[model samples]
Every structure is written in C-alpha cells, then in structure tokens.
Target: MIADAAKKLRENIQKVIVGKDEVINLTLVAVLCEGHLLLEDVPGIGKTTLARALAASLGATYRRIQFTPDLLPSDVTGLNWFNQKKQEFVYRPGPVMS
Candidate 1:
C-alpha cells in the first residue's frame, strides 16, 4: 500500500515537474517520515513549484509565507481583535493557520 501510494504521488507530481526523480523521491520519503524539507537554490529554480506539487500530490493544505524585511511575526501567527458584538478579543487566524 505504501509503495502504491508513493508511486501514485510521484506520478502526479511528475505531471508538473519534468525531471528530478531523485528529489521527488527524497521529498516523499521525508514527508512519510514526518520530516521537514528545505529547498535552497538559485531563484526561479522551481523550489516553490516542487513544494506545491508535493502538497498537491499528497492532498495536503499548502501555504507559503514570503518573508520580507517588513514582515512581522503577527502576520504569520495572526493577532487578536476585539469583536464589537461579543465585546471580547477574538483570535484571528493568519495565513499560516490555514
């Protein structure tokens, strides 16, 4: 079952990614082992593409956070806002929450 699932995932991701079978396999292995993957390379080298493809192949929710000099921690983790009706502070989820 695991092999079948892996094969299906690889095939699905291959539909968008042309090559890099080894990378795809390694990504699958990492995901299966509950590991995180960090793809660092020159710009426009398909890092985001690979991550999106992997997420799609695995039917997982994918969210990307672009860090900039002006980005704040609250932007990623969200903040509390006062609700007028409730008269209480409500935790608003950020992009990372989804």
Candidate 2:
C-alpha cells in the first residue's frame, strides 16, 4: 500500500516538476521513513513548489516559514498564553504544529 501511495505521489508531483525524479524519490523515501526534508538552494529553483506538490499529493498540512534574522523559535513552536476567562494557560499551536 505504501509503495502504491508513493508511486501516486511521485506521479502527482511530476505534473508540476520536470525531471528530478531522483530527488522526488528520495523525498518519498524520507516521508515514508517519518523524516522531514530540508530544501536549500538558489532562488527560483521550485523548492516551495515541490513542497506544496508533495503536501497536496499526500493530503498533508503544509506550512512554510521564511527565515529572517529576526525570526524566533517561538514563532515556529508557538507559546502559552493565559486565558482570563478560564484562568489557565492555553497552549497555542504554531506553524510547526500545523
């Protein structure tokens, strides 16, 4: 079942991405292994497109955060806030949680 799913995912991604079959395959392998992908390349290399394609193909939630000098860990991990009504700390999920 996983192989079939992976094949379908690859085919779906290929519709938007030309060539780079090896990269796609490795991405599928990484996903199947419960890992993440870190894409670092020069600008306009379809990195965001590839990630969006993979997420779409697998029906997964996708969120992208552009790192800047001022980006903080809390921005990705979220934080806890006090709820006045509830009088308790509420855990607010961040982009990484999605």
Q: Could you give candidate 1's per-residue lDDT for residues 1-98 as a string of tens digits?
A: 98898899999998988878888888889988999888888998788999999877777888899999999899999999999999999998888897
- TM-score of each candidate? 0.88, 0.86
Instruction: Compose the digit string of candidate 2's lDDT tens values, residues 1-98.
Output: 97788888889999999988888888888889999778888999888989999888888899998889999898999999899999999999889999
54 Cα displacement, candidate 1 (Å): 1.5
Error of 1 at 13 (Å): 0.4
Candidate 1 residues lying further than 4 Å off, grouped into runs, are none
On a 0 to 1 TM-score scale, where does candidate 1 land against the true structure?
0.88
Model 1 residue 20 CA deviation in Å:
1.6
